[model samples]
Target: MSLECVHMPISPKNLLVVSHRYRSFQKDPIDLVSPYFDNVYVLVRFNKFADVSKYVHIPALQPFISSSKIDYTNKPLNLEVYKTSMFNLPLDSQYKKLGKLHLSVVEKIIGENNLNFDLIHSHFIWSAGYVGAKLKEKYNVPFIVTAHGYDVYDLPFKDDEWRSKIEYVLNSADAIITVSNSNRECIKKLDVKTPVTVIPNGYRQDLFYPSDTFKCRKSLDLPIDKKIILSVGNLEELKGHKYLIEAMDYLLRIRKDTICFIIGEGKLESRLNKQIKLAGLEKNVKLVGGKPHNEIPLWMNACDVFVLPSLKESFGVVQVEAMACGKPVVATRNGGSEEIIVSKDYGLICDPARPKELAENISLSLDKSWDSKKIDSYVSQFSLSVICNRILDIYDSVLSN
Candidate 1:
């Protein structure tokens, strides 16, 4: 499987990117680099919401994604995929083993299509980075791994066995990229010697910018009389939605006009719904199913404030998106929030999972007068175009060696 093509790229060359998610509600790391590579091959681990049986039988790379539905304006990407359920019995010990299948699929595809890529870039450390490490070892090609949050902060500390796997992948990568400064600190603690770069996730200013709040509320049919407190993320335990729901009582006590909306879908919908009833927040809190990605900006524009009370967040892009729309944010002291709310000027950061603290922070944010133009300007430096070029520069640096 040794790919012997060693001619340096005087021009744009092929790039093989391995990741678990893509082109969804949020901006993807691949979205920044795809346009720079001549022909990009994306291998997605089909672990998104649905049952494993949904896309198991389909031929791999059968145009699973429609062209017209692309979230951003980027060059075409050759979308390829594989299922997590195909080998899904022992979910714990088998995920890393499943990564080998990605290599097998890529090798087979290359043999049939006569294709060769200059480098391999992977997203997370566990599955995609492990797969990329194997490819780099077998083919002698460059390998780069970008740690988002969970992989670097949580997974490595799971157990000795997990630590070994993470170390193997880290040792294999030529350069490591993280989205936040705190994420880089986590990497440093791991004693990793690989060249690491901290590249914060950028906001799409085109899709998310300050608009007339009243107009935005009218378009979304949101009540203008009440102050809208918004939290957007998948309704999972990690997101700390229950805590937010609990805070509704305190929030309502202070500002009875405030109503909170939780947007995004997950398995915890029914549980959250039940919690809403038990807490007697039925009238105040709402669990609206997954909002369309395009409509997220409208929610930001319409709401008085945005909140992300996650117990653990790697890099919360929605917080920045809300800021881009000139909305004040109330975030917990999670990994990325420490940097996102670095100054009181951007937003407020309080203790995580504490309903009272969260309630107080939300109240403070609601009362504060924010300058939308300042928040917009603060987030503009992390625009998608700037992030894309930063990645391309990294690619150039890695390839020259």
Candidate 2:
């Protein structure tokens, strides 16, 4: 599916982006779109606990906590980032109040730096979207929010109060952007009047293109003879790492020539490790903590197939990255994976959380002959250039209105 390139004329204006994690998928669009604007100001919300983590000695908690400081030495010249700390408690009732707290933190930063912007785009509806909504009221600027995963599908349906809060944020926005049709339907459940656009997450073309499989495997010190099955996601319950391990148990019964590498770190690390030991998959399935963002492309190239066993997803950007590397994907029928792996050409999809079904699909994918060039060609539509053009068109429309 080729995307039509919409080339809008660039105007001199500043853009303020409010994102919880500015370095992840949120950063992809900004990297491409920032050149068109005068300056792109990013406000990254950091947990106040990270400051305390610096003094405390907790190895288990360190993976979840990030440094409050952002090094901009290698960042884009037009991009300006502000890492601000906020008090966030992991309680269901405290969700709405966190919005006001976020607004207060943002207000302090804006006042101290005298930052100015013509528009605001926030990732995730809660807290960030709330801040955007409140700021839109204050400055009368156009505000757009991207509802990704939990913020769209889970939070709004939590309770009556959460439903009302989410509705307020959606209706308050000039426009809403979601990652998938499934998420768009979730927004429709609220029945907000605001226009919602679906812009699928994209991968960096320069970083994720095809490479030499032999060289990649050699560099990563992975076995060249084994059929590699790689899955990269945080080791959380919703990510379905446990199901993948279970599938491996079934997979090895038929074929022992495969190795599964799960790359990530989370609170569930110890529990998953214990599961691997009990299942006797310590040799077949290896939990290779987490790799750097840039190093992930090498892993993708080294693997024979990429698996995304997520139980729920808004859009699996990792699947697109793997496809860009000309590698086939075997993902679950999670909302986003089905849309990405639309046909049998790119990859196969199995029922979520089913170990036997997942194992069958993995074995089939490993034995099948896949055309790498076709898979690579199919993923071009979700490249950074195409996705950013669509987003910029939205920006132009909102500003012109």
TM-score of each: 0.88, 0.95
Worst 10 residues of 2 by lDDT: 64-73
Query: Considering only N, C-alpha and C atoms within 3 Å, which residue pairs clash in candidate 1?
Result: none
Score each candidate by Cα lDDT: 0.76, 0.88
| lDDT for each residue of candidate 2 in 65-97, tens digit (9 for 90 to 100) | 654134342477988888768776666766668
Q: Assess candidate 1 and give its TM-score to the true structure.
A: 0.88
| Model 1 RMSD, rounded to 1 decimal | 6.1
Q: What lDDT tens digits, residue by residue, belong to model 1 across residues 196-242? A: 99887777666888899999999999998998999998767789999
lDDT of 2 at 286: 97
Model 1 bad stretches (over 4 Å):
1-10, 24-29, 47-49, 52-85
> How many pairs in model 1 have backbone atoms within 3 A of each other, for residues 3 or more apart or on separate chains, i.e. clashes?
0
Q: Candidate 2: lDDT over CA atoms?
A: 0.88
